[model samples]
Target: MECTCDYILKTQPDWEEHYENCKVKWIAREKRDYPKNNDGTLRLRNKHLLKLDYDVLYHLGLDTKTHDLQAMFGDVKFVCMGGTKYRMKETAKHMANILDIQCDFKNIVKQGHRYALYKVGPVLCLSHGMGVPSMTIALEEILKLLHYAKAKDPIILRLGTSGGIGVTPGAVVISSSALNDTLEMCYKLAILGEEKKFPCNFDKRLNQELLSVADSEDFETHLGVTLCANDFYRGEARTDGAFCDYTEADKQTYLQKLLQLGVKNMEMEATAFAHFTSAAGVRAADVCVTLLDRLLGDQVTPEKEVLTEWQKRPAKIVGNYILKYYNK
Candidate 1:
């Protein structure tokens, strides 16, 4: 019998054989103690959800009573999220090409009136908007849809663009862990006027898998903690915002503080995305391509065309991973 060490999956040229050969699972942790149905699907903690006859996923424009969720999303393996409708739509087209689904793909959630949703074979792509709050709502709705659909072992990936810390522009960042504004490795949100927190941690094996596949691309990929702020300006210590109270020195100090703490990039939605997905028992990764190095400046000085090109870095790396993993 081959050793079931996680390294075998990363080191072997024929990783799928080793992945199957290994008795241990690397991701989608076996939460045997958690509530599960006879069919072995993990149940949500919200008992009210299970009791309800139907769930209306308002943001995703999906409802159990309206659409056959099991038929729409049950076969979904990957949930890929980006920042815009256009980006995710393009991603759907990209994945469709990769999956050899030759057709003029349509936005499945255009009727939703909020976010854009598209499906390419086993991949589900969506635009998560800008910040944690925006991203959280979309996440909750989609997660609920997945739960109602009884999707099996879905892997979520947030493909986004961020401001790199000490790293160079166009480098893709794979967050080993996510952090909030106060530097905690957790996500904080208000529930019932009080507060609650969920871990922003990620599976190291998934990070390794992304990093390994990144070698197949010409772009650089870095692994480190990610700072998930509520805003792109003040929260990220940028002077470019409308209201700037702090000096450039203060901003430098703060960003340097992040660098010392191993934060490779800063984004708006990582903590919420990491926490919510983890809470739902879905394995997720925050992989963002840096638009600019904050250590150099606060502004993204690249041209629109260049920025667009940089934004595709994560998709390419992730697309490569999907191809390699799915083939085997």
Candidate 2:
């Protein structure tokens, strides 16, 4: 019978695999009351293991770039934003069929969304959606995957559904800036003050890339401000009568104030994305398809199809824009 070391060697032929195997071995050795180095390379129990320096894990798959691209746009990466878990899975399978990409619908996870990595040209398109949490999680996963793949300054373009603030429904808005008002939570936590702000900057190159795509597609794209709030209903104050502690007159006044501020749409995750990724120095921006007209008193109920045919107009524009940018 082969020893664990030999077993790992037989199974993994790459550096990443070797590294992972050695890491596990180091941990196991430590649990056996053996001494180890701070970096987990040298071992007091057996200096022989030290010679196994080649990282099998790193080579176990492809290079970091290849892995990233595979994860980003492999046969299983494009995902839908905002819907029931079952619905998201069904939608993902359907999209894969439409895009002629391989898909796995059984991997549905948190908030009920499915993910697929699509291989398009030389770039990989990492996409997922179907509700705020799922969408946010999908973005987080993509970032982590990119980081693991050691991608250098990869661009992120979010194509999701959003509520029109002052703009007309069905309009496609290319978000030049995503303003996060949810940072108020940090203030509430007493970690900072209400005036303290943390905003993420979008990548200028990628933004221009998207704009060029929009122009080529002939879609009406607007570069406007988008507000990211924690709560959808209360954040936008869309609740029926008594939306907030304010009166009807106050609510109307607030709407007018927001419009004056030039907020074109409202969503839940963009701000968080900006705050987290900006801190990490990633170039990211959001492009959303306006599904509901918030100012027109149109509520985005669950009964609405996750992605209506009309919504496809904006999605197509955004998708093509992303494809063109990455292709370049």
Candidate 3:
């Protein structure tokens, strides 16, 4: 049963006292509705969060009371995200072909213009634009959506492109951990007038699974630390930006320092993506194809056909893994 306090609180003068009196009943109802894992434990951090009177995923065009989330997404087993809407749309089509799911993929989010989302059987595909802030907002809403839907232990994966540090172009780089520009494996954010640091960690078990799949397919894959920057130009130490105050020699030195620290690639969204997923107790992994070798040059120079084929590499491996998991 849904709690009634939320509706009453909007017009009631003394909602706090009402909540205090109804807290036990609400918590009990929550406990009874939520599903459990194999070991009889909830996978999400706050198991009863969505069971409260009012819960909303505003950015996702969804809310607990407005939609029946459990019926809509309770079967979702995998969630994939990238930087562009078109790419993820293609991915959804590809996933449908692999899984043999015949449903026509459609955009379920109509009210919000922030992101695009699609569903095919047990898989959910979404696009999280280009930076840390954009990725973070999408993730927060998705997590809440899953919570409200009572989705089971689902695996989340980020499939995208990055600039290689020492590896060759077109090679896949699976992030062992995401590091900031300072070479720290933590994300910094100012919360409540104070700075807080959260570890940028990935799922080691998932990485191994992806590596195994790549090896079986004979694909070139590298596992190393990834550097998450805030911008494409200055944040990445590139000299090609419109405004540059650094020299070529300075850029070379910085890239060399990152290579020493074991960073294999650079991108803009991994830090927040890894940090938030880990905090939410969701298993996550980042698999990106290298588009350019930063040590060789600052500009990306590859043929359209070559780039298109390279872009499909990460999806191939990730899609295979998801298929195998479901078949098992």
Candidate 4:
């Protein structure tokens, strides 16, 4: 009989073997005391998940049966997501330095095809690709992963770039709430041949914490509503697509209407991102730096260096918030 210490699964063959080997241990945890909040609560919506002997996070190439979820991810307190793999990897390293924690953190996903994920101490930085569908897929797996890991009260942050409405480029905007293209604060999803609506509310206190951090900095930051579009062109009222029926004047009018409704910026993924987190009883926030003022232009034409620095602003503020929360 092999000891449990030598049973870590790493390959396809070993993964299957380890699954069979860990049945006893996995089943044993069910009888033991599960971690919970002070009030004995679990944030995950799937309340009956503990009945399962094992679970696999396919896209992430990790399994609760093979890997020690409690040992691997129990310490995770923050999960930051962005649009690109490169940006997220950078954010992970940047966070490591900010927290003064040294880690030669490598991409944990063996196949880097789906999404890039890095774990630095208590933070899990992930690239969610783009748009609602992409974010939704990742969120589904991530929620299960956190649930299996028994992570306590983890706060998720979507740190990305967006086109500004009335604000200047390079300014940061912390989302007050996420609104869909219909100007409704609900995430509509087709489930079992029916359209279901989920409220897309964000954390007000998290917004204020990010805002307080912003106030201490020299750069500009605003707390306002974010319009989450399904597409970058027509869905966001842009005239620079491959085909556009609307004229530039029409685009201006649409943008003006959004501005009048208090929308500060436009992005592609906040609808599902905000709704799913809220549905799971976890606090989520979207902090985006304006890449370009849509009222001024349609294209993001900032210099490379300027764009890089602008992209890092939200991550810095988020890191500061995490540091402050831990220090206090």
Top-TM-score candidate index: 1
Off by over 4 Å in 2: 1-138, 182-197, 216-219, 241-244, 301-307, 325-328
Q: How many pairs collide in each candidate, listed in order?
A: 0, 37, 0, 0
Write model 3 residue lDDT over 235-308, tens digit each, in one string.
Answer: 99999989888999999999999999999999998888988876665667999999999998888889988998
Task: Give the lDDT ranking, best first.
Answer: 1, 3, 4, 2
Off by over 4 Å in 1: 1-32, 35-40
Local error of candidate 2 at residue 1 (angstroms): 57
Q: Please, what is the TM-score per model? A: 0.90, 0.59, 0.85, 0.86
Error of 2 at 136 (Å): 5.0
Q: Of the pair 1 and 4, which is ahead by lDDT?
A: 1
lDDT (tens digit, per residue) of candidate 2 on 141-196: 55544444444434454655678777766777766566655423221112455345
In candidate 4, the residue pairs with backbone N, CA or C atoms under 3 Å apart (3 or more residues apart, or in different chains) clash, namely none
lDDT of 2: 0.49
C-alpha positional error of residue 84 in candidate 3 after TM-score superposition, expressed in Å: 0.5
Assess each prediction's global lDDT (C-alpha) against the native. 0.80, 0.49, 0.80, 0.80
Rank by TM-score (best first): 1, 4, 3, 2
The residue pairs that clash in candidate 3, if any, are none
Show the lowest summed lDDT stretch of 10 residues, model 1.
14-23
Model 1, 31-118: lDDT tens per residue?
Answer: 4333334343446767788778888888777788989998988888789999899999888888888778764567888778889888
